[model samples]
Target: MSGKVVDDRDQLLGEAVGLRQAGKREEARERLVALSARFPQDAEIAYQTAWVHDTLGLEAEAVPYYERALAGSGLSDDDRRGALLGLGSTYRVLGRYEEAVATLGDAAARFPEDGALKTFLAMALYNTGRAHDAMEILLTLLAATSKAPEIAGYRPAIEEYAKDLDATV
Candidate 1:
């Protein structure tokens, strides 16, 4: 792409982000949808469009854009991660438990250290009737968190919650 086109795209993305940050989500989504149509092959645009839709609670509309973003090449790792997480959460919210589990599992494999991804994966597992697996993941996460000095204070509560979950399972 030409420098001018790149500059314009960047400017538009910035404006959309700014709008969303300013709590004008509907306007941001409208602008992003227009930009996405103009840059149909741009992974960043697709991701932004999907993000706006998802943030607006339009999960059904977000799904296609997230899929497009994931399918496109040249996305940064952060964008790819965001797309996967958004898609997985959207699937979960839509009650597509199997799809949520698969998507979140893939995300967890790719980003093992991302606690949020693991948490969501556990949720998907639990929703799919794999409560034992869900509790295991949560317990492991709690153990890891407890080892960190910054959040050690929460360890007791976490442990208690884990015990409660264990009892239920």
Candidate 2:
């Protein structure tokens, strides 16, 4: 790409991000949508567009953009993680449990230290009738969280989740 084009893309992305941070999600999405069309091959643009849609409760609309972002080769690790997590969560919201399980499982494997990914993976597993596996992951996450003094506040919520999952099983 030309330097000018890159600069323009960066400026547009910054504007969209600024809008989002300003609580103008609709405006951010609109700008991102236009940017996505202008830079169809840009994974960051696709990811940001999808994220705005997802944050706006338009999961169905987010799905295709997330897919495009994931399929693109230019995504950074963090961008890929966001796309995967968003796509998996959107699939879950759409009741595509199998897809959610597969997507979240893959994401969890790629980012094992991310407790939120594991939590979502557990939920997807549970929804897919793999409750035992889900419970195990949650339990492991809880165990890990309990060992961290800095995150002690999360322990209660983790324990409650464990209790709820155990009750279901």
Candidate 3:
């Protein structure tokens, strides 16, 4: 952060983000890499670097950077949420289902209102052969969030079924 004003650092981050959004993923990754070096303690930069690696299909390389970002406390609230989801999703993609479930479960507990986190956690739970648990989460989420007329009308039933799939007829 020394020798760089907050706005300058943010501008660099914005540039990297723009590159990623522009589909110049390699360039974004490069810019984030450099920014990470320049701001070694910057959680957001590390998180961005990790995300770029993930988008590039380099999940393995992204792990340490994600971990580094999460270990630091400099991330804003949204970025912290993203880091948790990113790391957990990366673990799932890497076939580390147990780790994914653990990480995503923690993230979901921390951000109960985050539907995305719950969705990913469901996937991880399924990967670990917790299909019933996964279905429960999915069903509850759907009941709570779906706007389809049919589902909307049956929200209470869906929620009840989500709690006990084996209920009597």
Task: Provide TM-scores for the models.
Answer: 0.87, 0.86, 0.94
lDDT tens per residue, model 1, 75-162: 8998898899999999999999999999999999999988889999999999999998899789878877666775676776666676
Off by over 4 Å in 3: 3-8
- Candidate 3: lDDT over CA atoms? 0.95
Say which candidate scores most in lDDT. 3
Index of the highest-TM-score prediction: 3
Q: Candidates sorted by lDDT, descending order?
A: 3, 1, 2
Error of 1 at 1 (Å): 1.8
Worst 10 residues of 1 by lDDT: 160-169
Error of 1 at 75 (Å): 1.8
Give lDDT: candidate 2, residue 126.
Answer: 90
Which wins on TM-score, candidate 2 or candidate 3?
A: 3
lDDT per residue for candidate 2 within 1-169, as digits (tens), equals: 8999899999999999899889999999999999999999888999999999999999999999999999888899988988999999899989999999999999999998989889999999898998988997887787676666756756766666665665643
- The lDDT values for all models are 0.90, 0.89, 0.95
